[model samples]
Target: MMMLNIDDSGMARPYLRENIVFNHAHTEISTGTTLFACQFDGGVVIGADSRTSSGTYVVNRVTDKLTPLAKGIFCCRSGSAADTQKVADIVRYQLDFHRMQMDRDPTVLEAAVACRSICYAYRDDLTVGLFVAGWDESLGGQIYSIPLGGMLLRQPAVTGGSGSTYIYGYFDREFRSGMTKEECAKFVSTGVALAINRDGSSGGCVRLAIISKDGVERRLIKGDCVPRFSIC
Candidate 1:
């Protein structure tokens, strides 16, 4: 017969053996990420720090958290890596079919809506927070934040993940209403780098996706290349 144990949260979970002790700390895997997206004059820039962890152990130090959904649309993933990746994969497949049927590229809003739908549907079971950013003929550049509960938000700039808490103040002070492409990319990279430095679970290289009317540009900034930040 199977054994059921009531955890501290009062949830019943299956266990193999009565003698075995379960430690939630060692079993949970988390993507301690630093993800952000910002809009510029021509397009949008999305960036993330590359780190995946299980408890205190670093599982993947160089994992890419920025996933490309369509031609110009990309999502920065945080929370449970498996859940987020699966959501992205499902959304990408849907977008591809939508494009073929419509005979046109999917809009950024369409992609964001798809994400929100999936997230909201599985909100009770899934733990995911994503920043979807891209460029379309209609909107030029767009940024959307899909938080844990599947709340979709349209914003000029958005940040999330464990490291995000460290840089909220920085973004508030540094972010501007309008910025050039180069300026926006710099702002995103700097903010991610700062978060990587401050958050222990967030480290590794910084990955960026810059989408514009022209096309998408990918940039990888190594740890050494990251700009130094010091508070006096």
Candidate 2:
């Protein structure tokens, strides 16, 4: 039996379920998620494809990993199962708390703080890689990313495991200025295709969510042409 390495970013482990465990316990499988965010005049476009795998086993396919955090704020994650679940719970709690205390809706900045707090608390136990999108008050449309160390970035980003290369390239070319949300939707569809075709660790279903100044809307676009994410 052997113990594996663990860190704030992520860890590598070998299978030894009975006699030993990696990180904290059993291996959580090499899974990942990729989220693409674009800042447009009208709103933010977030397209995430569902593809979770464990070694040779396709654990979950066509899953919904992207969700709306606030009215116009959306989040997408691809990383440790532990971190994902934890962040989600914290965000939910924060939103609930804010509603109870202020009697007002939580904003994107607040949501980011909630997420960062979780990362700081269990900074040693989780690998939280996430992207946050919304209409920035000053910048109009804004896209931000928070990786392991709470580093925020805005660059038409990508987050996930092995299949990142394929998806990142696809996003870079298709993403540009003045593209409509609909066009970005198509671009995301293409990105999903590239990930499914090239990355073995991802691809079962696709979930797409878009957010605007008005609100957030999601749909599952799995058809002959592309995979769906949320709404059926």
| Tens digit per residue, CA lDDT, model 2, 38-124 | 666677777666766554555677667775676567777778665686687678777878878998777676777778777767777
Tell me the lDDT of candidate 2: 0.66
Candidate 1 C-alpha lDDT tens digits along 97-185: 99999999999999999999999999999999988889999989999999999999999998899999999998999999789889898
Pairs of colliding residues, candidate 1? none
The number of the candidate with the highest lDDT is 1
TM-score of each: 0.87, 0.76
Residue 222 Cα positional deviation in candidate 1, in Å, after optimal superposition: 0.7
